[model samples]
Target: MHAHRKTRPPANLGPWQRLLLLWLLGPLLWLQARHVRRITPRMPEPPGQRAGSAGQGSLIRLLVAGDSGAAGVGAPTQEQALCGQLVRRLSRHHRVEWCVLAVNGLDSPGLHQLLLDTPEAAFDVVVLSMGANDATALCAPLQWACWQSRLADLIALRFAPALLMHSAVPPMHACLALPQPLRWFMGRWAQQMNLSLAALLIEKVGRSMHWHPSTTTTAGMAADGFHPSAAGYALWAEGLSQHILAAQIASRHHPDLKPCSAAAIAH
Candidate 1:
Protein backbone atom coordinates (compact mmCIF):
# COMPACT_ATOMS: atom_id res chain seq x y z
CA MET A 1 0.00 0.00 0.00
CA HIS A 2 3.02 2.24 -0.27
CA ALA A 3 5.44 3.20 -3.05
CA HIS A 4 6.06 -0.55 -2.99
CA ARG A 5 3.05 -1.87 -4.85
CA LYS A 6 5.62 -3.60 -7.02
CA THR A 7 7.89 -4.36 -4.05
CA ARG A 8 7.76 -6.71 -1.08
CA PRO A 9 5.29 -6.33 1.77
CA PRO A 10 6.13 -5.50 5.37
CA ALA A 11 7.16 -8.16 7.91
CA ASN A 12 4.31 -9.87 9.72
CA LEU A 13 4.27 -9.39 13.51
CA GLY A 14 4.18 -13.15 13.68
CA PRO A 15 0.81 -14.58 14.76
CA TRP A 16 -1.21 -12.82 17.41
CA GLN A 17 0.41 -13.59 20.78
CA ARG A 18 -2.62 -15.64 21.84
CA LEU A 19 -2.98 -17.33 18.46
CA LEU A 20 -1.51 -20.60 19.66
CA LEU A 21 -3.54 -20.61 22.82
CA LEU A 22 -6.70 -19.88 20.87
CA TRP A 23 -5.95 -22.68 18.42
CA LEU A 24 -7.08 -25.19 21.01
CA LEU A 25 -10.57 -23.77 20.65
CA GLY A 26 -10.36 -23.65 16.86
CA PRO A 27 -13.24 -25.93 15.97
CA LEU A 28 -15.65 -24.19 18.32
CA LEU A 29 -14.60 -20.77 17.09
CA TRP A 30 -14.89 -21.90 13.48
CA LEU A 31 -18.46 -22.98 13.92
CA GLN A 32 -19.21 -19.86 15.86
CA ALA A 33 -17.91 -17.70 13.02
CA ARG A 34 -20.14 -19.40 10.52
CA HIS A 35 -23.14 -19.34 12.84
CA VAL A 36 -22.67 -15.67 13.54
CA ARG A 37 -22.34 -14.93 9.86
CA ARG A 38 -25.56 -16.78 9.16
CA ILE A 39 -27.62 -15.12 11.87
CA THR A 40 -26.15 -11.63 11.70
CA PRO A 41 -28.35 -9.31 9.72
CA ARG A 42 -26.75 -7.91 6.59
CA MET A 43 -26.91 -4.15 6.76
CA PRO A 44 -27.39 -1.90 3.76
CA GLU A 45 -25.65 1.47 3.57
CA PRO A 46 -28.15 3.94 4.93
CA PRO A 47 -29.75 6.17 2.28
CA GLY A 48 -29.26 9.91 1.66
CA GLN A 49 -27.23 12.22 -0.54
CA ARG A 50 -23.54 11.46 -0.19
CA ALA A 51 -22.51 14.97 -1.21
CA GLY A 52 -23.92 18.35 -0.15
CA SER A 53 -23.25 21.91 1.03
CA ALA A 54 -24.43 23.48 4.23
CA GLY A 55 -24.14 26.34 6.76
CA GLN A 56 -22.65 29.78 6.06
CA GLY A 57 -19.38 31.61 6.60
CA SER A 58 -15.85 30.50 5.83
CA LEU A 59 -15.87 27.59 3.41
CA ILE A 60 -14.49 24.38 4.91
CA ARG A 61 -14.39 21.45 2.53
CA LEU A 62 -14.70 17.99 4.07
CA LEU A 63 -14.44 14.39 3.02
CA VAL A 64 -15.48 11.34 5.10
CA ALA A 65 -13.89 8.17 3.80
CA GLY A 66 -13.53 4.54 4.86
CA ASP A 67 -15.68 1.42 5.34
CA SER A 68 -19.39 0.98 5.99
CA GLY A 69 -19.09 3.22 9.01
CA ALA A 70 -18.31 6.11 6.68
CA ALA A 71 -21.04 4.89 4.36
CA GLY A 72 -23.62 5.09 7.15
CA VAL A 73 -24.82 1.50 7.48
CA GLY A 74 -26.76 1.50 10.74
CA ALA A 75 -28.50 4.85 10.66
CA PRO A 76 -31.60 5.29 8.49
CA THR A 77 -30.19 8.31 6.68
CA GLN A 78 -26.83 9.88 5.95
CA GLU A 79 -28.10 12.93 7.80
CA GLN A 80 -28.03 10.86 10.96
CA ALA A 81 -24.74 9.11 10.27
CA LEU A 82 -21.16 10.30 10.86
CA CYS A 83 -20.92 12.52 7.79
CA GLY A 84 -24.33 14.07 8.44
CA GLN A 85 -23.74 14.75 12.08
CA LEU A 86 -20.27 16.16 11.41
CA VAL A 87 -21.60 18.46 8.74
CA ARG A 88 -24.51 19.65 10.85
CA ARG A 89 -22.21 20.76 13.63
CA LEU A 90 -19.43 22.24 11.49
CA SER A 91 -21.93 24.08 9.32
CA ARG A 92 -23.15 26.16 12.25
CA HIS A 93 -20.22 28.56 11.80
CA HIS A 94 -18.55 27.46 8.59
CA ARG A 95 -19.82 26.68 5.14
CA VAL A 96 -19.31 22.90 4.91
CA GLU A 97 -18.90 21.08 1.62
CA TRP A 98 -18.85 17.32 2.13
CA CYS A 99 -18.71 14.01 0.30
CA VAL A 100 -18.50 10.37 1.28
CA LEU A 101 -16.53 7.70 -0.62
CA ALA A 102 -16.86 4.40 1.12
CA VAL A 103 -18.16 0.87 0.69
CA ASN A 104 -19.61 -1.69 3.07
CA GLY A 105 -16.59 -3.96 3.61
CA LEU A 106 -13.58 -2.00 2.39
CA ASP A 107 -10.33 -2.55 4.23
CA SER A 108 -7.16 -0.42 4.18
CA PRO A 109 -5.78 -1.68 0.88
CA GLY A 110 -9.08 -1.19 -0.91
CA LEU A 111 -9.38 2.36 0.33
CA HIS A 112 -5.84 3.09 -0.75
CA GLN A 113 -6.56 1.99 -4.30
CA LEU A 114 -9.87 3.81 -4.33
CA LEU A 115 -8.27 7.07 -3.27
CA LEU A 116 -5.66 6.75 -5.98
CA ASP A 117 -8.47 6.45 -8.49
CA THR A 118 -10.42 9.42 -7.11
CA PRO A 119 -9.96 12.74 -8.83
CA GLU A 120 -7.77 15.02 -6.78
CA ALA A 121 -9.57 17.71 -4.81
CA ALA A 122 -8.53 20.02 -1.98
CA PHE A 123 -10.26 19.73 1.41
CA ASP A 124 -9.94 21.65 4.64
CA VAL A 125 -10.62 18.61 6.78
CA VAL A 126 -10.92 14.86 6.36
CA VAL A 127 -12.15 12.34 8.92
CA LEU A 128 -11.43 8.64 8.51
CA SER A 129 -13.66 5.78 9.81
CA MET A 130 -11.95 2.44 9.35
CA GLY A 131 -10.03 -0.51 10.92
CA ALA A 132 -12.91 -2.77 11.98
CA ASN A 133 -13.01 -4.51 8.61
CA ASP A 134 -9.25 -4.85 8.50
CA ALA A 135 -9.12 -6.23 12.02
CA THR A 136 -11.84 -8.78 11.25
CA ALA A 137 -10.08 -9.71 8.02
CA LEU A 138 -7.05 -10.71 10.11
CA CYS A 139 -4.86 -8.01 8.62
CA ALA A 140 -1.62 -7.90 10.62
CA PRO A 141 -1.11 -4.77 12.68
CA LEU A 142 2.28 -3.86 11.20
CA GLN A 143 1.03 -4.31 7.67
CA TRP A 144 -2.01 -2.19 8.52
CA ALA A 145 0.26 0.54 9.83
CA CYS A 146 2.28 0.40 6.64
CA TRP A 147 -0.78 0.78 4.46
CA GLN A 148 -2.24 3.43 6.70
CA SER A 149 0.94 5.48 6.55
CA ARG A 150 0.78 5.42 2.79
CA LEU A 151 -2.90 6.36 3.04
CA ALA A 152 -2.06 9.43 5.08
CA ASP A 153 0.54 10.52 2.59
CA LEU A 154 -1.87 9.96 -0.24
CA ILE A 155 -4.49 12.11 1.48
CA ALA A 156 -1.97 14.87 1.96
CA LEU A 157 -0.78 14.82 -1.64
CA ARG A 158 -4.23 14.28 -3.09
CA PHE A 159 -6.61 16.33 -0.96
CA ALA A 160 -4.21 18.55 0.95
CA PRO A 161 -6.53 18.65 3.92
CA ALA A 162 -5.25 20.78 6.80
CA LEU A 163 -6.73 18.50 9.43
CA LEU A 164 -6.63 14.73 9.09
CA MET A 165 -8.57 12.90 11.79
CA HIS A 166 -8.86 9.20 12.37
CA SER A 167 -11.79 7.87 14.36
CA ALA A 168 -10.97 4.95 16.65
CA VAL A 169 -12.16 1.48 15.79
CA PRO A 170 -15.63 0.59 16.99
CA PRO A 171 -15.97 -1.63 20.06
CA MET A 172 -16.25 -5.12 18.65
CA HIS A 173 -15.82 -7.09 21.86
CA ALA A 174 -19.33 -6.11 22.72
CA CYS A 175 -20.76 -6.91 19.31
CA LEU A 176 -23.89 -8.97 19.95
CA ALA A 177 -23.36 -11.05 16.83
CA LEU A 178 -19.98 -12.56 17.67
CA PRO A 179 -19.77 -15.32 20.26
CA GLN A 180 -17.48 -16.11 23.22
CA PRO A 181 -13.87 -16.87 22.31
CA LEU A 182 -14.27 -15.52 18.80
CA ARG A 183 -15.55 -12.21 20.11
CA TRP A 184 -12.75 -12.06 22.63
CA PHE A 185 -10.15 -12.75 19.97
CA MET A 186 -11.51 -10.18 17.54
CA GLY A 187 -11.74 -7.60 20.29
CA ARG A 188 -8.11 -8.14 21.24
CA TRP A 189 -6.94 -7.90 17.65
CA ALA A 190 -8.88 -4.67 17.21
CA GLN A 191 -7.23 -3.19 20.27
CA GLN A 192 -3.79 -4.06 18.96
CA MET A 193 -4.65 -2.71 15.55
CA ASN A 194 -5.82 0.57 17.02
CA LEU A 195 -2.66 0.87 19.06
CA SER A 196 -0.44 0.27 16.06
CA LEU A 197 -2.35 2.83 13.99
CA ALA A 198 -2.03 5.42 16.71
CA ALA A 199 1.69 4.84 16.90
CA LEU A 200 2.04 5.25 13.15
CA LEU A 201 0.17 8.52 13.16
CA ILE A 202 2.21 9.99 15.98
CA GLU A 203 5.63 8.68 15.03
CA LYS A 204 5.32 8.75 11.25
CA VAL A 205 2.35 10.81 10.03
CA GLY A 206 1.99 13.05 13.08
CA ARG A 207 2.40 16.18 10.95
CA SER A 208 -1.04 17.68 11.72
CA MET A 209 -3.31 14.75 12.42
CA HIS A 210 -5.54 13.75 15.33
CA TRP A 211 -5.93 10.10 16.30
CA HIS A 212 -8.47 10.17 19.11
CA PRO A 213 -12.24 9.96 19.04
CA SER A 214 -14.08 12.13 21.59
CA THR A 215 -15.90 9.23 23.29
CA THR A 216 -15.62 5.50 23.82
CA THR A 217 -18.55 3.75 22.16
CA THR A 218 -19.70 0.65 24.01
CA ALA A 219 -21.72 -2.28 22.71
CA GLY A 220 -25.19 -2.32 21.17
CA MET A 221 -25.18 1.33 20.17
CA ALA A 222 -26.17 0.75 16.56
CA ALA A 223 -29.21 -0.45 14.69
CA ASP A 224 -27.54 -3.83 14.05
CA GLY A 225 -25.39 -3.55 17.16
CA PHE A 226 -22.36 -3.98 14.90
CA HIS A 227 -22.53 -0.47 13.36
CA PRO A 228 -23.14 2.85 15.08
CA SER A 229 -26.60 4.39 15.32
CA ALA A 230 -27.67 8.05 15.13
CA ALA A 231 -26.75 8.87 18.73
CA GLY A 232 -23.39 7.21 18.35
CA TYR A 233 -22.65 9.26 15.23
CA ALA A 234 -23.66 12.40 17.06
CA LEU A 235 -21.18 11.70 19.85
CA TRP A 236 -18.37 11.04 17.39
CA ALA A 237 -19.20 14.14 15.36
CA GLU A 238 -19.13 16.28 18.49
CA GLY A 239 -15.58 15.22 19.29
CA LEU A 240 -14.42 15.78 15.70
CA SER A 241 -16.06 19.18 15.53
CA GLN A 242 -14.41 20.24 18.76
CA HIS A 243 -10.99 19.29 17.45
CA ILE A 244 -11.56 21.09 14.13
CA LEU A 245 -12.91 24.15 15.89
CA ALA A 246 -10.02 24.24 18.29
CA ALA A 247 -7.53 23.84 15.45
CA GLN A 248 -8.98 27.02 13.94
CA ILE A 249 -8.11 25.64 10.52
CA ALA A 250 -8.86 28.96 8.87
CA SER A 251 -5.55 30.21 10.21
CA ARG A 252 -2.30 29.00 8.69
CA HIS A 253 -0.17 26.79 10.96
CA HIS A 254 -0.77 23.29 9.60
CA PRO A 255 2.08 22.99 7.12
CA ASP A 256 1.29 19.26 7.07
CA LEU A 257 -1.09 19.76 4.19
CA LYS A 258 0.87 19.61 0.97
CA PRO A 259 -0.15 19.29 -2.68
CA CYS A 260 3.08 17.63 -3.73
CA SER A 261 3.09 14.53 -5.89
CA ALA A 262 2.99 11.10 -4.19
CA ALA A 263 6.73 10.53 -4.70
CA ALA A 264 7.55 13.80 -2.97
CA ILE A 265 5.87 12.81 0.31
CA ALA A 266 7.25 10.34 2.85
CA HIS A 267 5.08 7.29 3.31
Candidate 2:
Protein backbone atom coordinates (compact mmCIF):
# COMPACT_ATOMS: atom_id res chain seq x y z
CA MET A 1 0.00 0.00 0.00
CA HIS A 2 1.05 3.56 -0.61
CA ALA A 3 2.03 5.64 2.42
CA HIS A 4 0.62 9.07 3.07
CA ARG A 5 3.20 11.84 3.07
CA LYS A 6 3.76 14.29 5.93
CA THR A 7 5.18 17.71 5.18
CA ARG A 8 7.43 18.05 8.18
CA PRO A 9 10.97 19.25 7.57
CA PRO A 10 13.91 16.89 7.84
CA ALA A 11 15.00 16.08 11.43
CA ASN A 12 18.73 16.30 10.99
CA LEU A 13 20.66 18.57 13.27
CA GLY A 14 22.27 21.76 12.00
CA PRO A 15 26.01 21.66 11.29
CA TRP A 16 27.27 23.18 14.53
CA GLN A 17 24.52 21.52 16.56
CA ARG A 18 25.40 18.15 15.00
CA LEU A 19 29.03 18.60 15.98
CA LEU A 20 28.08 19.45 19.56
CA LEU A 21 25.50 16.68 19.76
CA LEU A 22 27.93 14.12 18.42
CA TRP A 23 30.59 15.29 20.84
CA LEU A 24 28.17 14.77 23.70
CA LEU A 25 26.32 11.68 22.43
CA GLY A 26 29.10 9.75 20.75
CA PRO A 27 30.33 8.09 23.93
CA LEU A 28 26.81 7.13 24.95
CA LEU A 29 26.06 5.73 21.51
CA TRP A 30 29.19 3.63 21.67
CA LEU A 31 28.32 2.34 25.11
CA GLN A 32 24.83 1.46 24.06
CA ALA A 33 26.13 -0.44 21.03
CA ARG A 34 28.53 -2.39 23.19
CA HIS A 35 25.86 -3.18 25.78
CA VAL A 36 23.45 -4.35 23.11
CA ARG A 37 26.14 -6.56 21.62
CA ARG A 38 26.78 -8.19 24.98
CA ILE A 39 23.09 -8.95 25.52
CA THR A 40 22.03 -9.91 21.97
CA PRO A 41 24.07 -12.69 20.48
CA ARG A 42 24.61 -12.49 16.78
CA MET A 43 22.22 -14.66 14.83
CA PRO A 44 23.07 -16.20 11.48
CA GLU A 45 20.80 -15.68 8.51
CA PRO A 46 18.41 -18.58 8.17
CA PRO A 47 19.79 -21.40 6.07
CA GLY A 48 17.99 -23.71 3.63
CA GLN A 49 16.79 -23.66 0.06
CA ARG A 50 16.46 -20.13 -1.32
CA ALA A 51 14.76 -21.10 -4.58
CA GLY A 52 11.55 -23.02 -5.11
CA SER A 53 8.40 -23.25 -7.19
CA ALA A 54 4.87 -23.98 -6.14
CA GLY A 55 1.24 -23.90 -7.25
CA GLN A 56 -0.19 -24.24 -10.78
CA GLY A 57 -0.69 -21.02 -12.66
CA SER A 58 1.16 -18.39 -14.67
CA LEU A 59 4.80 -18.28 -13.63
CA ILE A 60 5.75 -15.36 -11.42
CA ARG A 61 9.39 -14.47 -11.12
CA LEU A 62 10.08 -12.92 -7.73
CA LEU A 63 13.18 -11.38 -6.23
CA VAL A 64 13.58 -10.62 -2.52
CA ALA A 65 16.64 -8.47 -1.94
CA GLY A 66 18.16 -6.38 0.86
CA ASP A 67 19.70 -6.88 4.32
CA SER A 68 19.43 -9.19 7.33
CA GLY A 69 15.67 -8.92 7.58
CA ALA A 70 15.46 -9.85 3.92
CA ALA A 71 17.81 -12.73 4.63
CA GLY A 72 15.45 -14.01 7.34
CA VAL A 73 17.97 -13.80 10.17
CA GLY A 74 15.68 -14.35 13.15
CA ALA A 75 13.76 -17.28 11.70
CA PRO A 76 15.14 -20.82 11.77
CA THR A 77 15.04 -21.15 7.98
CA GLN A 78 14.13 -19.31 4.79
CA GLU A 79 10.81 -21.12 4.90
CA GLN A 80 9.86 -19.05 7.94
CA ALA A 81 11.19 -15.68 6.81
CA LEU A 82 9.71 -13.00 4.55
CA CYS A 83 10.83 -14.62 1.30
CA GLY A 84 9.29 -17.98 2.04
CA GLN A 85 6.15 -16.44 3.45
CA LEU A 86 5.70 -14.24 0.39
CA VAL A 87 6.30 -17.10 -2.00
CA ARG A 88 3.77 -19.26 -0.20
CA ARG A 89 1.13 -16.53 -0.26
CA LEU A 90 1.66 -15.58 -3.87
CA SER A 91 1.84 -19.17 -5.00
CA ARG A 92 -1.84 -19.58 -4.16
CA HIS A 93 -2.61 -17.54 -7.28
CA HIS A 94 0.58 -17.76 -9.32
CA ARG A 95 3.30 -20.34 -9.76
CA VAL A 96 6.14 -18.48 -8.07
CA GLU A 97 9.85 -18.95 -8.78
CA TRP A 98 11.60 -16.88 -6.16
CA CYS A 99 15.23 -16.05 -5.39
CA VAL A 100 16.71 -14.07 -2.55
CA LEU A 101 19.75 -11.80 -2.75
CA ALA A 102 20.53 -10.37 0.64
CA VAL A 103 23.23 -10.05 3.27
CA ASN A 104 23.49 -9.34 6.99
CA GLY A 105 24.23 -5.61 7.14
CA LEU A 106 23.61 -4.11 3.72
CA ASP A 107 22.56 -0.50 3.34
CA SER A 108 20.65 1.13 0.47
CA PRO A 109 23.71 2.06 -1.58
CA GLY A 110 25.26 -1.30 -0.97
CA LEU A 111 22.13 -3.03 -2.26
CA HIS A 112 22.11 -0.84 -5.32
CA GLN A 113 25.73 -1.76 -6.04
CA LEU A 114 25.00 -5.43 -5.61
CA LEU A 115 22.10 -5.26 -8.04
CA LEU A 116 24.32 -3.49 -10.53
CA ASP A 117 27.02 -6.13 -10.22
CA THR A 118 24.56 -8.99 -10.71
CA PRO A 119 23.38 -10.01 -14.15
CA GLU A 120 20.11 -8.56 -15.29
CA ALA A 121 16.97 -10.65 -14.93
CA ALA A 122 13.34 -9.75 -15.34
CA PHE A 123 11.07 -10.20 -12.34
CA ASP A 124 7.34 -10.00 -11.91
CA VAL A 125 7.74 -8.59 -8.41
CA VAL A 126 10.59 -7.20 -6.32
CA VAL A 127 10.50 -6.85 -2.55
CA LEU A 128 13.17 -4.87 -0.72
CA SER A 129 13.78 -4.90 3.04
CA MET A 130 16.28 -2.21 3.91
CA GLY A 131 16.97 1.13 5.72
CA ALA A 132 17.45 -0.09 9.30
CA ASN A 133 21.17 -0.59 8.74
CA ASP A 134 21.35 2.77 7.05
CA ALA A 135 19.84 4.40 10.12
CA THR A 136 22.24 2.54 12.38
CA ALA A 137 25.16 3.69 10.26
CA LEU A 138 23.97 7.31 10.51
CA CYS A 139 23.46 7.76 6.78
CA ALA A 140 22.29 11.32 6.18
CA PRO A 141 18.77 11.78 4.85
CA LEU A 142 20.02 13.56 1.74
CA GLN A 143 22.52 10.80 1.10
CA TRP A 144 19.88 8.15 1.61
CA ALA A 145 17.55 9.96 -0.77
CA CYS A 146 20.21 10.10 -3.44
CA TRP A 147 21.02 6.44 -3.08
CA GLN A 148 17.33 5.50 -3.13
CA SER A 149 16.76 7.52 -6.29
CA ARG A 150 19.69 5.82 -7.93
CA LEU A 151 18.41 2.47 -6.79
CA ALA A 152 15.03 3.17 -8.35
CA ASP A 153 16.73 4.17 -11.55
CA LEU A 154 18.73 0.99 -11.55
CA ILE A 155 15.64 -1.12 -10.97
CA ALA A 156 13.90 0.58 -13.84
CA LEU A 157 16.93 0.06 -16.04
CA ARG A 158 17.42 -3.52 -14.98
CA PHE A 159 14.80 -5.82 -13.45
CA ALA A 160 11.74 -3.70 -14.30
CA PRO A 161 9.38 -5.70 -12.20
CA ALA A 162 5.65 -5.25 -12.51
CA LEU A 163 5.60 -4.17 -8.87
CA LEU A 164 8.31 -2.99 -6.50
CA MET A 165 7.60 -3.21 -2.80
CA HIS A 166 9.64 -1.41 -0.16
CA SER A 167 9.35 -2.47 3.45
CA ALA A 168 9.24 0.60 5.67
CA VAL A 169 11.89 1.34 8.24
CA PRO A 170 11.29 -0.71 11.36
CA PRO A 171 10.10 0.90 14.59
CA MET A 172 13.49 1.39 16.12
CA HIS A 173 12.12 3.43 19.01
CA ALA A 174 10.26 0.37 20.22
CA CYS A 175 13.29 -1.91 20.11
CA LEU A 176 13.87 -3.25 23.62
CA ALA A 177 17.50 -4.02 22.83
CA LEU A 178 18.44 -0.40 22.22
CA PRO A 179 19.31 1.91 25.09
CA GLN A 180 17.46 5.18 25.66
CA PRO A 181 18.97 8.04 23.66
CA LEU A 182 20.49 5.72 21.08
CA ARG A 183 17.13 4.16 20.28
CA TRP A 184 15.51 7.58 20.24
CA PHE A 185 18.20 8.91 17.95
CA MET A 186 18.06 5.97 15.53
CA GLY A 187 14.26 6.12 15.47
CA ARG A 188 14.25 9.77 14.45
CA TRP A 189 16.87 9.13 11.79
CA ALA A 190 14.95 6.18 10.45
CA GLN A 191 11.79 8.27 10.27
CA GLN A 192 13.62 10.93 8.32
CA MET A 193 15.10 8.38 5.96
CA ASN A 194 11.73 6.73 5.41
CA LEU A 195 10.11 10.05 4.63
CA SER A 196 12.80 10.85 2.12
CA LEU A 197 12.42 7.41 0.56
CA ALA A 198 8.64 7.72 0.28
CA ALA A 199 8.87 11.05 -1.46
CA LEU A 200 11.44 9.72 -3.89
CA LEU A 201 9.33 6.67 -4.70
CA ILE A 202 6.21 8.71 -5.31
CA GLU A 203 8.15 11.02 -7.57
CA LYS A 204 9.92 8.31 -9.51
CA VAL A 205 7.84 5.13 -9.50
CA GLY A 206 4.39 6.31 -8.47
CA ARG A 207 1.77 3.58 -8.21
CA SER A 208 4.07 0.80 -9.31
CA MET A 209 6.02 1.19 -6.07
CA HIS A 210 4.35 0.14 -2.83
CA TRP A 211 5.40 0.90 0.75
CA HIS A 212 4.55 -1.59 3.50
CA PRO A 213 4.62 -0.25 7.03
CA SER A 214 6.07 -2.19 9.93
CA THR A 215 3.42 -4.54 11.28
CA THR A 216 5.72 -5.72 14.05
CA THR A 217 4.73 -5.44 17.70
CA THR A 218 6.71 -5.87 20.90
CA ALA A 219 5.72 -9.50 21.11
CA GLY A 220 6.67 -10.00 17.49
CA MET A 221 10.32 -9.16 18.12
CA ALA A 222 12.98 -11.85 18.11
CA ALA A 223 15.27 -12.73 21.01
CA ASP A 224 17.53 -9.82 20.13
CA GLY A 225 14.57 -7.45 20.23
CA PHE A 226 15.92 -6.13 16.93
CA HIS A 227 14.94 -8.60 14.21
CA PRO A 228 11.39 -9.75 13.71
CA SER A 229 10.08 -13.00 15.08
CA ALA A 230 8.40 -15.60 12.88
CA ALA A 231 5.03 -14.03 13.67
CA GLY A 232 6.34 -10.67 12.51
CA TYR A 233 7.46 -12.15 9.19
CA ALA A 234 4.02 -13.66 8.68
CA LEU A 235 2.38 -10.31 9.30
CA TRP A 236 4.75 -8.60 6.89
CA ALA A 237 4.07 -11.17 4.18
CA GLU A 238 0.31 -10.84 4.60
CA GLY A 239 0.44 -7.10 4.06
CA LEU A 240 2.76 -7.45 1.09
CA SER A 241 0.51 -10.02 -0.56
CA GLN A 242 -2.40 -7.61 -0.43
CA HIS A 243 -0.43 -4.94 -2.24
CA ILE A 244 0.87 -7.39 -4.83
CA LEU A 245 -2.65 -8.55 -5.51
CA ALA A 246 -3.75 -4.98 -6.00
CA ALA A 247 -0.92 -4.36 -8.44
CA GLN A 248 -1.80 -7.49 -10.35
CA ILE A 249 -5.38 -6.30 -10.69
CA ALA A 250 -4.25 -2.93 -11.91
CA SER A 251 -1.89 -4.44 -14.43
CA ARG A 252 -4.66 -6.64 -15.76
CA HIS A 253 -6.73 -3.59 -16.62
CA HIS A 254 -3.85 -1.81 -18.29
CA PRO A 255 -2.24 -4.53 -20.29
CA ASP A 256 -0.48 -2.12 -22.61
CA LEU A 257 1.16 -0.23 -19.80
CA LYS A 258 4.77 -1.07 -19.03
CA PRO A 259 4.80 -1.80 -15.35
CA CYS A 260 7.32 0.23 -13.32
CA SER A 261 8.38 2.34 -16.27
CA ALA A 262 9.19 5.92 -15.31
CA ALA A 263 6.37 7.22 -17.45
CA ALA A 264 3.93 4.58 -16.24
CA ILE A 265 4.62 5.35 -12.55
CA ALA A 266 4.75 9.09 -13.12
CA HIS A 267 1.12 8.98 -14.13
TM-score of each: 0.82, 0.82
- Against the unseen true structure, what C-alpha lDDT does each candidate score? 0.71, 0.72
Which 10-residue window of candidate 2 scores lowest in summed lDDT? 258-267
Which residue runs does candidate 2 get wrong by more than 4 Å?
A: 1-23, 206-218, 249-267
All candidates: CA RMSD (Å) = 8.9, 6.9
Give candidate 1's whole-model lDDT.
0.71
Q: Quick one: RMSD of model 2?
A: 6.9
Clashing pairs in 2: none
**Over the stretch 1-267, how does candidate 2's per-residue lDDT look in tens digits?**
112322232265544654576688999998988888788878899887776667768777777888998899888889999889988898899877677888888999789888887666656777888888888888877688777667767876677676777777776766667888887677667776777777776655432344445333555667887888787787778888888876672212224333232221210
RMSD of 1: 8.9
* CA error at residue 207 for candidate 1, angstroms: 5.6
